[model samples]
Target: MQSTAKAGPSHESVVTNGNGNGGAKSTPPTQRTALILYGSETGNAADLAAELASLTTRLHFRTTCQDLDSVSLRDLLKPTLIIFVVSTTGQGEFPQNARLFWRRLCSSALKAASLRKVRFVSFGLGDSSYPRYNVAHRMLCARMLQLGAGEVFERGEGNEQHPEGHSAGFREWIVGLREKIMQSFPLAEGVTPIADDVFLEPEWKLELATTDGTNGVMEGNVLPLRVANGHKSEPSSAAFSSKLDGTTGVVPNEDILPVKGAFTARLLSNKRLTAPDHFQDVRLLDLQLEEPYDYYPGAVAVVYPKNFPADVQDFIDLMKWQNFADKPLNVISTASKQLSPSPLRHLDLTHTHLTLRWLLENVLDIMSIPRRSFFASLAHFVGTATEDEAYQRERLLELANPELIDELWDYTTRPKRTILEVMMDFTMLKIPFEYVLTVLPMIKGRQFSIASGGAQRLDEGGSSMRVELLVAIADPPSPIIKYRRRYGVCTRYISSLQPGQQITIGLQPGYLDVKAEEMSVPILMIGPGTGVAPMRSMIHQRLAWARSMGLRTAGKRLEGDVLLFGCRSESADYFFKDEWHDLVEREGLTVWTAFSRPQTSTNAGVAGATDGDRTATRKQYVQDKIHEHASRVHEMLVKQNGKVYVCGSSGNMPKSVREAIADVFVECGASMAREQAEAYVDVMERDGRYKQETW
Candidate 1:
């Protein structure tokens, strides 16, 4: 989606003496305003920011909520207290929406004390499993501090690894958050914060199309939907007939998305990379673009998957919304009585049209486990006609209570109960049809790293522009529920694709940032499993560059390039094995293989020159292999001024791999003190010499 708005000059610029006016107490609570900005790859951070806005509003502060991309560093110069809610995506890079603002914040044009009066506290939503956990928020906080912005409170981190998930840490932070902000702008005389149970109006409101508004309302307290030269317009059913696909509204074709630019890609092939007997199912997809696309190894392909028809029908039946499922409703901004654009205008809907079933099937996520916020919101919508219904509503409210955290986990997370299942269980909960948009989270497009890129990655045979992806299917059987597997919405859809099937996709600039590097710059690559995808792309392109310069294919060809590949066995999941061997033999690229699942360790067999380890006694991972070859790794990194590119799962793999690299400096070549070695790596990361692309 595009940025909603541009950053204008500050309304009330306040220059402070580094510590005084950032959170100036002159303004009363009612006059005090808070600006909440979020950088969310998924809907998590945005949703959290919205909740925070609601809570802050109840405290008698006028609050404004927006995405980071919608504003700039200049916007922070205002006297208003700002709160940043950011999430790191794709190798610890800023999410797409936040990138522009982040770049502006980091620009060297501004003086060190540029944001001296910008008062803010930041909260990061992240998974600690990755090595660069909460790096985006941490960096933003550090940058703001460096630029002399006053911290209204110490920053907070919400780790998904917590037993109670992100909410656990959030609850703790929010307790301090409320207190901290309230202290900064104390409640006016005899005023107290509104009770938590008190209902607050939603930010967005829904209005049915009346006879006078059938063509779509454009004035007087209603949201205006404009097209072309900004002529006032509003949502109408005809918008659906012209723009949205029939029935599902998520059909895979042109005009499906990207009001600005979107293209179709036909599936050239969808081959399973993993062996049939292997427990994990992985597929290699080859998609040929209808338009000529740029070749970038680390770029991402954004895809939106459709929900299964059966699941959508089940949810409709549970909600008892079949009768009006097809009717369109105009969503107006409750907070902005003035004109505001609908978020989906980018979908080419001249006027927005939302049908209940159409939204459920194409826009709302019903398969993922429901968060506690879902329970809290749904409890307000329940109808307690009978004694059983009253008990169910009470149960829903109880689950929302922070005191019963474990109980909430059991009822939702542990069983992985989805929205549909929750609706089935709490039959008394009947959310009004118009309020569905506010209750349900928005569906976000999933991004998969492009596997194929470079000069040799294209076919000029007048057919298609090619991009590839290595995807692993997620369909494990549910632990508590039988007869159904926990299938991931996007991955499952990807696995069902057939050759020649065209789907809508957008190419996103990958975070790899390797394309501009010189061919002679050495690269130490560490990739296990499908992480090899980007590495393969870079290697081929590097080799192609060397060839273009008429250099020898061996030692002179992108000299010191090395790839450390780890997998279960040489026989299975040794993805692109033959290609690696060929590159080693012909292009002077060093390739190391670590096979973990073999029963016993096997000899090098080849004098430790060509093929890497044959087998390991116990399970050997990429980190283990990094240690064995630490000297060579240190030589490439320290002596040759090389770069390191690591790609893999965001789980413990990235953290373990990073620690192993740190160990290499102390134990192998550099032999510096532990702290110094870590500092060195940190410097490399800051300088962009060390990069990771873990999902």
Candidate 2:
């Protein structure tokens, strides 16, 4: 049996017993139905939800996976089992894809009896370093319970920063979830669940077809080019352009473009932002767009970077696929009935002919940390003759077991080992190409806040615009075997680019939700380290507007515009120092800087001093500076109705800043209790007077 209805903003439908392939017949409904819904900003939760749906299907239940926003209250009420996989984003806020659903759920009209028949379980993906870890899923579970939904099991929290990695907690939770399901709803007679096999059944099958001259090549399709000595053909200019346009025909330079997807841009320059002797390596990159693109001050530029050539070659060597590296191949699902829905299903596979090398480099994320299932899958391919293979298979199975999670963490995550390294280490385990494709994670782009102002242009004609980015090259805490230095995939790829080199990119609207062009009141921006990127954009824009209006400070002190910036040392990492001074002089901008490490000249040598330095002047943090100017900040936020913007590390910076602001309300003789002061900040957030962009 199958049923369909418009569920969410994407207009996606919930389906049961229906394969994803068109024209495939639906299976009869099972005794019970389950719904696996997810809200994901980065697709992690969605992937988990899909996996759970497949598992439930094997258990003889009619299961459907859909985004939370797509399903209404009425739809949610029907499911006997509802599994929620959600990720928390931006200071206890729901993912953008789930915001509308969350708002509707929060409506007072939905009483306790609305979801009385529903039985639910929740799995949250979060970073434990944040103050409001797993807040989104926690809120959802609480609200559902209040609406009379029965809990199938305790809510599971998957910590990305966990010592054993998020998969450790997830694997443990799934074991418990399976037990709960079995107890709650026994399988019907004559129905048997699939065994926990080591080898994954092929969801997708590989097929090869000889290119016929009659069919014209599809746009963006990777067609094999004939080359001498059986070499692969270079990517044609048309193919490059088509890849930039993605599935959507609209060019990136158009005024209105999709918030996410691939686009093309040229590297104009890559200049070092910090001194050579500095411990941190920061680069100032300038990318030239094809044409003037309309973007707000706080917008972000997403770069779709490829794997390092060396790493890609390493993977190819390990797979022993040099012979088939350039061979044309097509992928299609083996079963007519799709076990789970996949974005890859939409691709016209008949027209696509991708090479093995291209798939490894452009399609899969080989460098990602492997989940527990990955190890278990590899064990299936291990040869049992050699003691090493036998030991490895046993060890891998143990690692997959949730009870030995710490050992798994030590072996893989703590050392920051990549999947490629793990495969190389297990010399006897040779995984099939099709299995590898099914298991590997998809490559995603890295997003950076655009640092340039909206008024700035690369050239006089404005046909091409220039945008700046500040990137800090990542260096692992300690070097691993075989690798000299560890670099973030995207940052390293960007750093390797030369002037005039073209790169594929995309644009994503800023999540700060503050519009600089619509501002009518004073703004206070707090940014530390590289967090100054978006703040710089906003400051430049405001200064440009002030210049056009001929505005200036009438007195000794500036009013309205304020920026609080923090960094390690004034000489080493003070970004745009001269620009800030110019803005203060020309546009009446107020600026405050907190240097966590200050350089002081001494007889011994020029030494770096911190807050502990007694003889030398003390170093200060931005939070401390805010505490010092409590009254002034209170006046700006409460009395003057000014907006507060924070951009920085997700760890403790955001929480510290909020605490500092709350203290201002209490210390300013307002007679407000601490709880009330905190609530005041919550009100500011809800009113859109306070915004934050943190990673």
Candidate 3:
């Protein structure tokens, strides 16, 4: 069932009112109906709700999943089960997609009455390293119970980040919920197969024109192109093929221009920072932007990445689908819903172009592994089926069953294994392609905290900005795949590019939630590793502003600024060592370091050579350092009136630091209430005094 009403009693109804005047509608009389309400960020929760509807429909139960914003309180009370799946984004808040739904679900008025008949189950998806891990899911469960909603199943939480093993806690928990439902609800009688199909067709008006004046290609229309065999790097033509055979496709446009005059920069310098003896290889990069691409010192430059040729080839080897090593194949949304739309939309077909090899290596996530069900499905087709395996056929059931597949690619029955190599063995693996394509989200661009305000220009008429970025080197321990040893996409791509390499990319201005004026407010920056990129820019801007105003104090006295950086060592992996020192010695800046494996006084001169006795100890990490200087950090915030910023891995150090700050607030003044302390934390975040950008 579908409802588009945005508000009022009719908006809350399941059945339309008899009046043709377009007014309130009456829902079916009180009956044994099931409501599948969802709060999703990237639609994961909604997808689950749909799947649940499918399952419920098979049991002959009426089901509906509605956006929380459009749902009425009366509708919620009628649900036999309320399942919620939500993701925690930036600062433990609701995902942007779920914000509106969450706001109404927790409204002050809804908490007043009992929702006694609602038998609900909630599953939350969150990264453990975040400070407010699973906070949204927890909030909904608590609120629902407070409203007297009956709990058929206890709330379940899943962690996306598990340093040691695959994180499928949520998936596992969900299986248990399914079993519980089967046991509780008897079959309603001879049930019909779930509707032929059930997926929302979100409307996209063509009025939102593309840069180039054309109706972007429709699905099923084939566009063939010839391209050279090379990496998905610049200079190589990147193209793919698709057909209009009952599918959707995004027409290829010669130009999808980014913002006008987007910043153009030169590769000032690049150098490897890691010691030759170390297993890992890291680099320090410096770039100089030309013209009006000026920056506000604290901003970061977003580098576009290209795939390595060798890695791309390996991925092609695994897919074994086609020698797309050279020839591009027709790509389509292998997705199920496009069939219904007579004139399929552009997105129904993803912009799937380029050779299968290019798609696997550069476009598709190579690191992801095939779902166990993918293996089970192929079992019947490839003649690889055994009597035991034949007993159970569904891919979903096999995936949940847990009989592991040996050699991940063997399951796919494909010649090569790109998915297993890229997303999984390198470190971790997301679900299979079907799941990723069906359940997960797309890979998004990384946002860096901008670092520098450009120095004054010779011509007073134009302006430009400077940005700093920390190059990230990735080296996954893989004896199986040698290509896994290279650096990451974005950072590695930037590191290899030459001075004159012109590139096309996008820039997302700061959400405007955080902004600072020149020379007016002091900023405290706490970033380790690449997180320091923006801090460097901020420091540069502060200095430029001071220089522009001619304010130079003797003991670094003008504006308040503090920078904390963490790394493996000082000599080898420390980024921008000299640049940071220059900011201090030459430009009067203060920079601090938290070396996790810094060379102790006794371990000096341990470079360029490997001594068997050269053992490094783990010193304090960024979080510990934060705790060590909590009092001073607090004084800087409360007394010095400074802002706090953080960047880096979202899972660990960032959460630790925030928790440490909370601890500091409590210890320094016990009299301050807990909510008051939380308020302070919130204040810092809301004001950009406390800000973060984590992966």
Candidate 4:
């Protein structure tokens, strides 16, 4: 829908971008505004919220959409319609982007009447497999209600395991929401809501400076270059440092990272885990913290990764944004909402002169797979004049259509097609430089489980502590684009690093909540592929506990710590295989392995192979091993109340593992029904006896 609201100020008048020209925001205020705040980890919740925001705009309401942390508590006090779409993250914790907002909401100073004028509704995205499922959505709703916000409709919950997935539930929820909006706040007579096919105006508007020779694409020195190891190094100093006031000057690298409490670390080791012929390349990275830092078992390190310089330049050239590449442009939020902690974020964007090249190279996520909202936005950029253009634009619109979700997934998500790849596919598509922020997603940090800590983490010199990460490089061939590959942007950045290279990393608390004091309780760990990282950390932590408990001589197996590790081949992807024998004999650790594809040359690598290990015949998976060791699992879980932790990729493995555990409960329990077995597993999850830290 075309906005009838009068422009309040020039683009330059608002925006307190660190640039010398920016000042306090001076745009129009909210009137009949619909605030849609989302908290997402995997971008699903944010994408859904963005889609709803566009729909709300089409319904003739002023819409403001952003992440939960971006807006202040005062914004919630506004007398307006509010909608929250939040995704539950690790355990029951709020997503990292939404933690600050959750903390603020928990303030004792907030009165019950603070949100008296706010009418709101909530939608949750979660997995039913989790005990504290949908906690993020539930917590927000309950808190808002306590603050006197009126509920306009019952909350809608989206389960990831639903037959059609979370998006299916959102499809149904949005349909009901549209009806509620019409009933609650009817549009004025003779004014109609925008058609479903129409595209809303971009929330962000960029104003270009006068076009001149100097403003066009600057060659070579657009970015500073330095040599390392007798070759040109990647932009490290100024790439992370942007002069927001638009100056091409270097600033102190003190605040190189946007996240608070981040520390610099140097790469000490980057060793490949898999064989050279392996389809996937896995690396075991050891990083030495330049400053002292502490993290517990299952803790994660969030690394901020940059795009490959060549890819960034390719994106600029592809868009024909040469003239605007080096030119500094002014950005203004045309809407009430300004993204702060989202992909469309305010981290380094504000501090720089805001050149197109700078945005691509340092800020934007050009390699991320475009969500459905991206296609909807892309539909606005291309024209439909010629037959070829019409077909391309029509297809983009089709992908954006709410009814064609399956088609959209088939075209984009399943193929893992990146934004740059999408643009390349549509030969006629060229988005305006001003709309780049709105079209492109921001470069978010990648989290890898800290694989090293405890005894191994501390150097023998007692001078340095190291944190390790097991990163599986993603560079698989694309199904749709046969000629191109799907190289993960963050993984690519990580793969290129050399020893002694410095980088900033953020630390995250783990959900396992394991304590060193729990020395008597046994623990069951199931880790496959790179998921073994966390399990490795826990083992190191257990070793430290053994030393502190004065049981070092016979301590490793004192608590009966068991790790059920799985991989495809013993000599190919079996991470940490060499250490198993030493751990079994010296540490008293029990290790079980499942090799889906065994090597023809030798047996599966179990240092002290038991009868069960020797008898394995055909291909086997982790879940199969769990079932084979059902009695032991039942003993540790039910009889002893030991904690069981599952760490792996999200797809079908977690669900299968949960089922295998439940099956064990059924087998062990006296006359236990299937329902009773499932219920018992649920209880274990509720009691925190069972925990999963999957992607």
Q: Per-candidate TM vs. native?
A: 0.84, 0.80, 0.61, 0.82
**Preferred candidate (TM-score higher): 3 or 4:** 4
| Models, CA RMSD each | 6.7, 8.7, 11.0, 8.0
**Where is the poorest 10-residue window by lDDT in model 1?**
9-18
What is the overall TM-score of model 2 with all chains considered together?
0.80
Report the number of the highest-TM-score candidate.
1
Ten-residue stretch with the least lDDT total in model 3: 200-209
Using lDDT, give the best candidate's number: 4
Alpha carbon lDDT of each predicted model: 0.71, 0.67, 0.49, 0.72
The Cα error of candidate 2 at residue 271, in Å, is: 2.0
- TM-score winner, 1 or 2: 1
TM-score of model 1 (CA atoms): 0.84
Candidate 2, residue 172: the lDDT equals 85
Q: In angstroms, give how far residue 15 of model 2 lies from its true place.
A: 14
